[model samples]
Target: MAETSETSAAAGDAGAEGTEDTGIDPAIFSQLLPFDPFDPAFHADPYAVYRKIREQGPVTRTPLGLVVVPGHAGVSAVLRDNRFGWGDGATVAEHFSEAPDGTTVRPFIFMDPPDHTRIRGLVGQAFSARRVDALRARAGELVTELIDKAVAAADGGPVDLIDAVAHPLPAILLGELIGVPPEKHERFRALSTDIAHGLDPSLFLTPEEVTRRDSARAELYEYFGRLAEERRAAPAGDLISELVTAEDTDGGLTGHELVVTLTLLLSAGFALTVNLIGNGMYALLQHPGQLAWLREHPEDVPAAVEEMLRYDPPGQMISRVALADAEVEGVPVAAGEQVMLMIGAASRDPEVYEDPDALVLSRPAGRNLGFGLGVHFCVGAPIARLAAQVAVAKLAALDLELETATPPRAPYIITRGLRELPVRLTAAD
Candidate 1:
């Protein structure tokens, strides 16, 4: 979830829109603004800034009139509401494009009703919970294999868990699930990283990075287009085959739609699961007592995973445009307005969670905006959760210690993940 060009550009146009739209003085707008997205300190600890935003009341306005919803209730409301979406593509047009063949190439997650409803409905049939749950046993097996290989390669030295497990686990599973050949998993992972970084708001990307991101997306589209054709000629048991068959249904996904959808599923799913595993492991290491509790109560690992998502979600911000004049938890929003739903901030809102800042492994599972809610909810959530649950559960059994108290954070803010989580591991004496 990168900011659409309109919202990102709004930051530049804020001076003019500030007084004209919201009657807020441009000079004092900086004081009213949320944490600086570019600051490394903010990346390390955005919760502090989230707390400050919460103090400003549930909904705050950015200088350019983009609405900021930091409260859990308000954020959830907008997500579940019908009136807010990527309407007319004015807000997120950067992410959506016209394919060279002149077909619309927007991810369904960014589309408004009717279009979104149709594609998601078809996608859901293939991405069912039953289908996803079938992978748990295999996921566990893969995690065990990955961890053993990591520890053996470490040879008692520090290993970067992210490099060893978090990144590879999802890439491998998604490859298997999406019909990508095992030989190409590494290539998929590399492309996923480029696209994931590109997914950050352009404000945060260097020109070189932007070029890489665009190039990666183009390559992936071409790769999937070829794969879709193969699956069409001879359908397989993977998700791609199921999606290909879906094209036969009336008003079903076109060839271009299939490619973009798979791209979204693979890239977004990879980034989300990787961060969930990386962030969950880091949180558990930071809170050893909770880690120990989870080890003793292994059945509670599912609940613990939920807590991890709430504590530090992978997708930090979700962008939406008000399709029509709407009210979010009583605040009136004009039509065509852009809203920034701070998932990180909403998840930790004190009004929703007790000791919002603390990580409690046993904290009862409740709704968190991590995977979002309503129709636009993550279609690949079940698979992502399964991958992370297996990865985290497998790693928790080991004798692990963080090599550094503060590991470096990923440069991109959208996917709040570590570049690498270096750690020491050994067999229990």
Candidate 2:
């Protein structure tokens, strides 16, 4: 989370690279009902808007034909059903498929079965359970060090918890996970931040912001390409080296695919995980009952993290295109129509969770759409979970107070997060 002028000015919306959209008219969604990225009020509390959307029905359509699914069951059905995807790039939003340079390569997240299965499988090979699990101890150590620095830096005043722990913790670990040298950690964080703001549809951003995003993407592409080449020549014990050699029935990835995949993993993983920690902490501080409960039941950190995700998710919307005629919760969807799944709305659907809006750490562990579902479930979920749990548990051990009850949230519609969470921290005696 190296902040740029545009990113900071915009209140720091975190965008996932590759998911950035160039075409498909963000203007349509901006003006339409049930979703408005430009509205400051909506950004502050989108769940309130979501409640209105859910009241409409399982599915609602704009005059422009964008299908909006706000109910939990409908959103889940669309995600798991094979009939919905970015088929043949026709239904895929240009931002998700096309680059600023006019090239088109749908990231695996947007691809259909064969291609999606192939690339994701190769990626999964590199992202082994053993590799991810091994990072747990290291993550805890990093959180401890970061919290210590935040406590020391406060000097009896409010500190930006995001800068102290949420932002850097994930960036450092992601660098370690991807084999980035310690020297380049700051650069890595900065580029990812620029790309994160650019992750919103082009319509929501200013011209300058879009330019910075594209520029950052190009720079990252060059960097990853060089790194991949280096790894190919002499493989290291890092995930980048592992990815260089990852193969399946289709054989190894091309140099370009390797670069794209690496960039995707780095950018997407970094943004979501950063927001999870930031948003989760903000939620806890808002609910003192839950915060006290977490302190009393330290073992429940993981469960509390899940509840945080559901209560105020990092990734709020997931887009899908119908490949063929299909139905979501009995709503007919023609081929080529785009369906926007409001994850924030579905997670809070009263039909699914008891007191869906409450921050209930003790709530039963159940299926959630926080990281998504089916083939596209977040690949970095295990690591993200580990990072958030460690950060939350450590932060909760302190006497914490929010400097501002209602923090400024990023205005980006797709992802939901606070710009900064200033908290007064003191060690528990």
Candidate 3:
């Protein structure tokens, strides 16, 4: 998504207070500071604030002149609109360079059409529907293996589901997909988490986090680079190898495009999937009726997966910059303005779905911006859906009682999901 001048200015003002003379509402400014994108508290529970913004209007201008699109229709409109441009590396550098260390991180997913088109097209072939469906058997096998280990570890005792299943399953899957060695999984997993956290702007990091992020980036680039080189020499079955040889009308991705594309796929590929599984499990356990229903009719697994995504999406929101001056949901937004599309809030908008707050597995499948919309829709969506279907099916089949220690939510806002989900299982006699 593109970042607008309004958003950059608002974010630049960070913790400052606004006055009537400044043409900014004090309440709006207060909400903006406390709800910084990186704040853990915001991640824990943002629905209330989302509600507030939604009721205020579909589009509301902030003290910093940035517009916030909160309602279901409003958020959906932004996602579906083509006029908004995805910002480039320079934009990211401008927004994040204010940090103490002043290092810039660029992932190709953040670029505009032609560039995004070229990069995404190269990697897109690997995540084709057929390829993802073909992996279902493997995905199910992996889930079963992880579940077996979890059941054994439980031994009539409690198990931290996140550590045993939630984290490792997707990590292993992504690793295998990218051809990372089994032995290097643990190291790479740790690095991925740290780097993901570093991307959060609200998490005030010490110099240590800065150093770790830089190091992680270097290591990841080097690792993927070597793998890409090997793929060039002799292609393999993995995604990297496929990208190394992929071609589009324009041409194949360059070395830099390949690196950036791989980086984004690696970061997004596992983190959100793990969260989807973990969060979906937690939700089902909390609502046992839904759990039992899913278990009783395995045929409903696909619908259940969609409901899970709509109910508590792994990605809370996405940003876009206005390519031209446009009025969104009646609010006038100038060109180069930044708009935040609240996907989570939009899914829960009562107008879009009946009982937006309630989780209904059988609800008619309406459009969901959860995977995004328009040309920038998530490329990994098919694979993610297949993986989730396999995961939820296996989970529903198990004879288990979910014991929630605490409501699960990540400490970061952009990618939201369960940190840890603890549960108990009763072995089949």
Candidate 4:
């Protein structure tokens, strides 16, 4: 998740208010003294702050008690290295305590080394290309079904694509893939979205929002825990079944691990895929030439989808705590210190791509950290990519038109996507 804190100087909400910027690098302070995420200005256009941060060299120490790495080279380097990690079980348990139920639930991704290896291997099988591919036929069916509804709703009148399709497609697809029945989809979507916001609560949310996150965490565990019971009662060959019933080298997963893994599968990937489709469509519409090119060359939709991931990923930031003292790209980081890797900024860094900001559909996009890197790389990446590839190609094939100069942007710091992306079908136009 993208880190949010120390609203810009414009908002005057700096580094938890009363705290001084005694440790912030002078260079970053001069350019972004108060990088205000709380300010309306930042959410509307966070890239501006990121650009400024990126310009201040590879890594800038922040007064927020973490170093911000915005440059492409540094961000990518940190992600690929193992010295930095997010699987500190102690930290995770501390976080869970704030929730009403206060239970420690460690997802496989949060496990390091041998633990990660065991869980990933089992979970990996469920997401292997072959396993994920089996779902594509259904995914395509859902896309077509959603597009049909979108077309009918638009009737040449503008409609929010997210409302009509983007959000539902993945919400439904993930529900089915994870063994969630159609009846549970609405509740699943709501719980997943709220729990995802818990990733970096203090970094970007208001007090009430943080409270909502805490509540969501407890509810999410309960919701998924029930599903685990169902999967155990009757095996259905679902991902949940695989997780609940399968055994790893280190015996079968603990019960806590099972519930937490389900939670991760349900919440972690749900919201982001919504954004992926939203961000992809927005990018296509913003660049008409590219949009037109995509419509004509639908065969190359996968490449276009890749470009979208590189251009403006849904999940924008990754945080890691140093396991031991380590230097990233020559910048010193002490043990236990946190580093925020700006996924969005690095994707746009000029050092990484020639004309990085421009969305060239055919560019060799290389390995974008949109899905993260190394151990914690997103497990659902293949599924998310396939969703964009197929759904985007379908939308392009439909020739939907952008209905406004700017769609409503999702007003959050760490996440970027539209609140509502208004579009109209060609028949409506």
| Best model per lDDT | 1
Better by TM-score, candidate 3 or 1? 1
lDDT of 4 by residue, 1-429 (tens): 323233211111223431232333324433443265545667666777788988887888766566788877887788777787754554444233222255555566556676678888777866768878888888888888877777776676776888877888878888888888889889877777776655552433445546777677677666667777887898888888888877765677666676667667766687788889999998888888998898778888988988998898887776667888888779799987767788888888887789887899988858778888887788998889888888888777766778886787755445667779888776322
- Global fold similarity of model 1 (TM-score): 0.91
Local distance difference test, each candidate: 0.81, 0.79, 0.69, 0.71
Quote the positional error of residue 275 for candidate 2 in Å.
1.2
Instruction: Give me the runs in candidate 1 sitting further than 4 Å from their true place.
Output: 6-33, 201-204, 247-249
Query: Per-residue lDDT of 184-250 in model 1, one digit per residue for the tens?
Result: 9989889988876666445434566578888888898899999999998999889999998874256
Local distance difference test, candidate 3: 0.69
How do the candidates rank by TM-score, highest first? Answer: 1, 2, 3, 4
Show pairs that collide, candidate 2. 15-196, 20-95, 21-95, 22-95
lDDT (10s digit) by residue, model 2, range 231-325: 98999989999999898877988777777777777767787888999999998999898899999999999899999899988887787778899
Ranking by lDDT: 1, 2, 4, 3
Instruction: Name the candidate, 2 or 3, with the larger TM-score value.
Output: 2
Q: Residues 354-425, candidate 3, lDDT per residue (tens digit)? A: 988777777789887778887778877877787788888887777767675475555545566776777787
Residue 105 accuracy (lDDT) in model 2:
59
Segments of candidate 4 deviating more than 4 angstroms:
2-34, 39-41, 87-103, 202-216, 427-429
